[model samples]
Target chain A: QKEVEQDPGPLSVPEGAIVSLNCTYSNSAFQYFMWYRQYSRKGPELLMYTYSSGNKEDGRFTAQVDKSSKYISLFIRDSQPSDSATYLCAMRDAQGGSEKLVFGKGTKLTVNP
Target chain B: GAGVSQSPRYKVAKRGQDVALRCDPISGHVSLFWYQQALGQGPEFLTYFQNEAQLDKSGLPSDRFFAERPEGSVSTLKIQRTQQEDSAVYLCASSPDGNTEAFFGQGTRLTVV
Candidate 1:
């Protein structure tokens, strides 16, 4: 099975809508979860990161992780056109140093005005 | 520079030709990583450097691919013989330390004919 899996959604939503992006992973050793936003011709940019199974909120974005279920999610409230980009889920092992990140196929989101 | 910088924002190379991509990571970052991103896929690990020492290279697809960070800050990824399959965006990232969040640069879009 792929280490990380995500739906490559060309999801379109109207502005001010609530958007949820999720990812599932097969690796039990993944301890750090991260969400990245990538615009066309640009590299992925770190949006949020969480280490434990819980919820973290930053402005209009929230990140949730469930270690037991091996699932993670990013919730964007009041989505904006600026948020239209590819959202990628990434995870890293518990190794303190020399760690590598495993990524999922990103979901593309478009917020129409 | 304040952020990671990758040169040659885009490149087109003939098949079987050699290509060398450069990455200048953020100053003082202890870890540097290289990744390849296809059109619709997330970034895939390529290689890593902890200072001038190459600690992990298992992610490299073949022996034809090599990366180096001679001074522990500036790094380069060299592809000996480019193939059509090698057409992808080469991304470079750096972190203050092994366990810290990483910052990525705008990738180099490579097109191998």
Candidate 2:
């Protein structure tokens, strides 16, 4: 199985809708979870980051991690057209020596007016 | 520089040609990483450097790919005899330290014909 798995969603939603993007990992050693947003022709931009389990909130975005289930999620509340982009989930273990991030296939999202 | 910068924002090369991509990371950052992102996929880790020392390169796809950070500030990724499969957007990211949040560059998109 791949280390990280995310649905390649071409999800379409109306403005102001709540959007949830999720990813699951098979590697139990992963300790840091991150969410990135990428627009076409640009690189991925860091959105939210969390260590271990639990949840973190920043403005209209929230990130959640469940280490017990090896799953992670990003929720966008009252989404806007500016939120239309590809969301990527990334994780890395606390190996101390190496911090290479493992990423899943991103989910493409489009928020229409 | 305020952010990570990559050169040759777009590159097109014939198959079997050798190509060199450059990355200028944020000043004083201790960690530098290179990732490859294919069309519609999230970025995949390729290699990492801690200052001028390369600590991990386990994700390099093959012997044809090589990366170096001679002065610890500017890094370069060189692909020898590139193939069509080598076509992808090469991204560079850097962080203040090993375990901190990383900032990415506007990647260099490479297309091999």
Candidate 3:
């Protein structure tokens, strides 16, 4: 099984709609969960990060992690066209130094105006 | 104030040719990372450096791929005898420390034809 799995969604939503992106992992050691946004032909940008299991909110974006279920999610409220991008979920074990990140195939999100 | 920067934003090389991609991390950052992103996939870790020391290279796919951060600030990923499978975006990122969030470069899109 892949270490991390995500739906490669070309999910289309109208502007102002809410969007949810999710990923599941098999590794129970992963402690740092992150969400990245990537545009076509560009590198992925870190959007939200969370340590362990909890919910973190920053502006219109929220990140939630459930270590028990090995699931992580990124929720975008009031989505806009500019929010269209590939959403990637990545995790790193708490080994404390330069640990490699495991990533899921990103889900493409398109918010139509 | 500068984010991570990469040179030769786009590169096209014939198969079997060698290619070198450079990355300039945010100043004073202590950790540097290299990742590869194939089309429609999320970035995967390649190697990591803590300052000038290469601490983890377990993620490197093969001997043909090598990365170095000789000066502890700027880094390079060199692909020897590039193959068509090497066609992907090479991303560089840096964090203030191993436990911090990372900032990524725009990435170098390498196409091996």
Candidate 4:
């Protein structure tokens, strides 16, 4: 089984709607969870990062991780057309450092105006 | 400061040919990483470098894949005898340290036909 699993969502939402993206991992050792946004033809950009199981809010985005469930989520509030892109979840064990990020297949999102 | 930068934004090579992709990490970053992203898939770990030292390379798919960070500032990933399966986007990222957030490059899209 892949260490990380995410829905390959081509999820479509209207502008101003709320968007929620999620991922699950089997590795209990994972301590750092991150969310990344990738536009077509571009590399992923860091969106949200959280250490361990907790919630972190940044601007219009909120990242939540439940270590107990090995699940993590990213919620985008008041989404806009510019927000359409692929969202990816990545994680690593606390001891693994920044070099060993394991990533889940990204969820594609399209926000129509 | 600039984010990570990669050269040859796009490459198309015939099967059995060799290809070399380059990455310039953010200045002074202590950690560098390489990842491969196939179509519709998230990025997968390839190799890592801490300054001039190659720390972990277990993620590389085969012996044909090689990466080097000779000066600790710029890194290169070379694929010898590329196969069709080698077609993917090669992404490079760097962080200030083992625990810091990583910044990614625009990535080099490689196609082995």
Each prediction's Cα lDDT score?
A: 0.94, 0.95, 0.93, 0.94
Question: Every model's DockQ, to 2 decimals?
Answer: 0.81, 0.87, 0.78, 0.73
Model 2, residue B34: distance off in Å is: 0.4
Tell me the spans in candidate 3 whose CA falls farther than 4 Å from its real position: none
The TM-score obtained by model 1 is 0.98
lDDT of 3 by residue, B10-107 (tens): 99999999999999999999999999999888899999999999999988899999999999999999999999999999999999987878888999
Give the TM-score of each candidate.
0.98, 0.98, 0.97, 0.98
- Candidate order, lDDT descending: 2, 4, 1, 3
Can you write out model 2's per-residue Cα lDDT over B11-62, one digit (the tens) per residue? 9999999999999999999999999999988899999999999999998999
Which scores greater on DockQ, model 3 or model 4? Answer: 3
Clashes of each: 0, 0, 0, 0
Top lDDT prediction, candidate number: 2
In candidate 2, the residue pairs with backbone N, CA or C atoms under 3 Å apart (3 or more residues apart, or in different chains) clash, namely none
lDDT, candidate 4, equals 0.94
Note the B-chain TM-score for every model: 0.98, 0.98, 0.98, 0.98
lDDT of 3 by residue, A1-113 (tens): 99999999889999999999999999998999999999888778889989999999999999999999999999999999999999999999986566678899999999999
Tens digits of per-residue lDDT for model 2, A12-107: 999999999999999998999999999989888999999999999999999999999999999999999999999999999997689999999999
Docking class of 1: high
Better of 2 and 4 by DockQ: 2
lDDT of 2 at A55: 98
lDDT per residue for candidate 1 within A1-113, as digits (tens), equals: 79999999999999999999999999898999999999988888999999979999999999999999999999999999999999999999986455788999999999999
**Runs in model 1 lying further than 4 Å from the true structure:** none
